[model samples]
Target: MTKTRLFHSNANGLIEHDHNRDGIDRRGFLKCMAWAGTGALCLIEGGVLKSFALGTRNASQVQSHEVAGRLTFVQISDSHMGFNKPANPDVIGTLKAAVDKINALPQRPEFILHTGDISHLSSPDEFDTVDQILTATHTPIFFVPGEHDVLNDDGKTFRERYAKNSKGAGWYSFDKNGVHFIGLVNVMNLKAGGLGTLGNEQLEWLRDDVKHLPSSTPIVVFAHIPLWTIYPEWGWGTEDSAQALSYVKRFGSVTVLNGHIHQTMQKVEGNVTFHTAFSTAFVQPAPGKADGPGPMKVPGDQLRSLLGITDVNYVQGRHALALVDASLA
Candidate 1:
């Protein structure tokens, strides 16, 4: 079985819980872990993501400087701009709140990765508004398309607007500070229940993309849908991700990031860490917890608590990357 560590945000602080069941205690806190501990211990507060420093015992909050990472970036997914519904009457407000968190990071991220669903209905105005808000950060941004982004057209406009450097089906790769990052487009030709599909062409390109890199090089792959099967019954997984992952399985460290399920879920298998991010606009029912997956409405006061952002830090020379999910609340 794959080993996974999960921390859920609560009114008090982060709560380590059983992934199989939700038995969270609102007053509990994730036990403090030393900076150099075996696994990461994230403390969420004031929208800042930080790690406990060495020699520190138990603290609910600390400074980002306490974290050790040469490369740090932020991930915000499934914004669903222009979506004005009871589930989330103000998607723009929540999305902006998410950006505010990125801007508030004591250590501003080097860049931002918008996983997908940039627009609610692939409308030009929705795309324009998001672009305007994101530009305020004055940071380089990267993107991949969600199925919703390509509804009107088969990603032609999306490719021209956001993925000019991409290869077949809006897939692309780049390097930053010795780390290789790949932006994949699996939302195209989605199966029922939004199961993502990465055609053979993109898989071939991926195979050749990292063939020459030393296995020690860390790899970060971001897409709109989960590469690992989250809930195949709900179409929450990629149709042929096994073949795609096979290409990079030999690498010492591989981190796969995705956004479609609109919630945080993680799995560590061998050298791979598969993580799904929460949406900024709204939340969805946990896998199989509801009849299906869609916008899950909640009390207006509790919306932000369920929405959040993900911060990823890569500590150079350690082959280690830490990911923390913090709520906008």
Candidate 2:
């Protein structure tokens, strides 16, 4: 395995780059894109947030002991399994690489959380390929539908295969390790500029769902598009997320995970931390960095490094959770 450079956000609101054997000079790269492609490992415990790197330790050791005794899960987004373009011709191959990365982890994640875009086209074959490949991890999986996943049939197939237990539009919630996990579907009705929308029905369900939970419960909300405003011109945000977020604001710790942009970006608001994971299929330009959002073909040598996975851990009784991002390279 190649040494991975980890980028994290510190208390001072600055991103700290941990240099490693890769010698990629991340500071210079971050300067070029304003820190756009950097990934993060977020630790939120006791209502406080802290950041750390995956460091130069042995991969297995880092995986096994990074966040012992905490609730740990893996977040992978935008697999786009059927995509076959110059940006990435072997989507299945890369997806397998992601599975391999997870399987090699010393500590198996309790479950794999796939934010969205499991397929480029909502075809049976596409979904099947994704399902077959992901099974190798031997871990239960959770999903939220991305715009691409609902393209033709309004997510009819996606919901049938991956979200039967979910409610209208496949939105659902469950409890795990004392944490509340909510999977939301926002790609059903897109607003102007392609922004995501969580209809009133889903919003109401969300309100009632968390109404009974104690304020101390940690909430992990996953969706296809970002719940916060992130370059609305590009349709990177949700139109009614404010209403949804309003429901969880009283909670002490809320972590919102999303995928769609194909790169990593994070924001911290009062009690909410919004994070976007990278795509395993291909990379997309930074917000407004290109004319529009789509597959971006980078130098072949750099593709794997630009694509990666996010590992998240929450230590019991600790006031923080730890997240580590590792590249396929």
Candidate 3:
């Protein structure tokens, strides 16, 4: 098997390729492991994907920082279901582990926000597989488009499958527990190594969308692409993101969540907090660490240890939110 690394992205997760020395790549082969702690293990075998989980815990054990009874939800980014690579043959199995991790949370999220790229190739089977696994959870799933999900038929399938009640081509807003949630689409027109864009039409709608809300309202904005600068040379940042952020600047509490980079990173600017999630799929080289960002093929034994998820808790009046990134490693 030969090990070749390919890098891909979607709304809330990053997809990278891992190759075996024999010159072959399996889309999804996985395994489960335990080392006396609460973490899951994923691996590949015979070019087939397999996985298992350990130390399942209750989600409620995690505390809530809500000061004024703030509404809370879980954000799950990129899960490239149909993906098969040398990294792990069982991409779906790992994704299931992620969902299991989420379902096992002590506090069930109000809903699940899937940043984008729910499937690997925009294929029916891939989407179906993701849906079947996520269905195990009782929470509702909201989604935005990632570049990979729209590659086929101009995202017709993606829009139909995930954008139920979403306004104007997958951009929409909702009110939950006195908080405002805005979902934007920026990966549709992405260029190779270029920033993600939010066209004039979407901008206009966004302005009108939040026009009636009071500035005191807390806001949560999610999309597949990062709203802030994160290695623009690799197309990790957004083009019209500034315009979008400008509209939300008046709000006292603004939390921006995105996926696409495949790693967990956080940045705070003024009252706005930006967070990116890790890929349940595989790992990637850090920014500028390699000639270009792609799936960083590591030794098979270390693969599961490097993957995990993020837990976010916030209180209404609190100035700082606490985010815990649990790496599979």
- After TM-score superposition, the amount by which residue 5's alpha carbon in candidate 2 deviates from its true location, in angstroms, is 18
Clashes of 2: 7
lDDT at 304, model 1? 91
Q: After superposing candidate 1, which stretches have Cα over 4 Å from the reference?
A: 3-69, 191-194
lDDT of 2 by residue, 58-118 (tens): 3344345656656789999999988999999998989999999899765789999999999
Cα lDDT over the full model 3: 0.68
The per-residue C-alpha lDDT of model 2 at residue 164 equals 94
Off by over 4 Å in 3: 1-70, 191-193
Ten residues in a row with the worst lDDT in model 3?
28-37
Per-candidate clashes come to 0, 7, 47
lDDT of 3 by residue, 176-210 (tens): 76778899999876665568998889999999988
lDDT (Cα atoms) of all candidates against the true structure: 0.77, 0.77, 0.68
Across residues 1-329, which tens digit of lDDT does each residue of candidate 1 receive? Answer: 35333345322224444342323211232332221112234433332233443224543233334344468898889999999989999998998898898887756789999999999999899999999988978899999999889998899988989999789889999999888999999988765555679988999999999999999999999999899888878888898899999999999879899999888877766667788887999888888889888789999888997788887877665544667676787
lDDT of 3 at 287: 80
lDDT for predicted candidate 1 compared with the true structure: 0.77
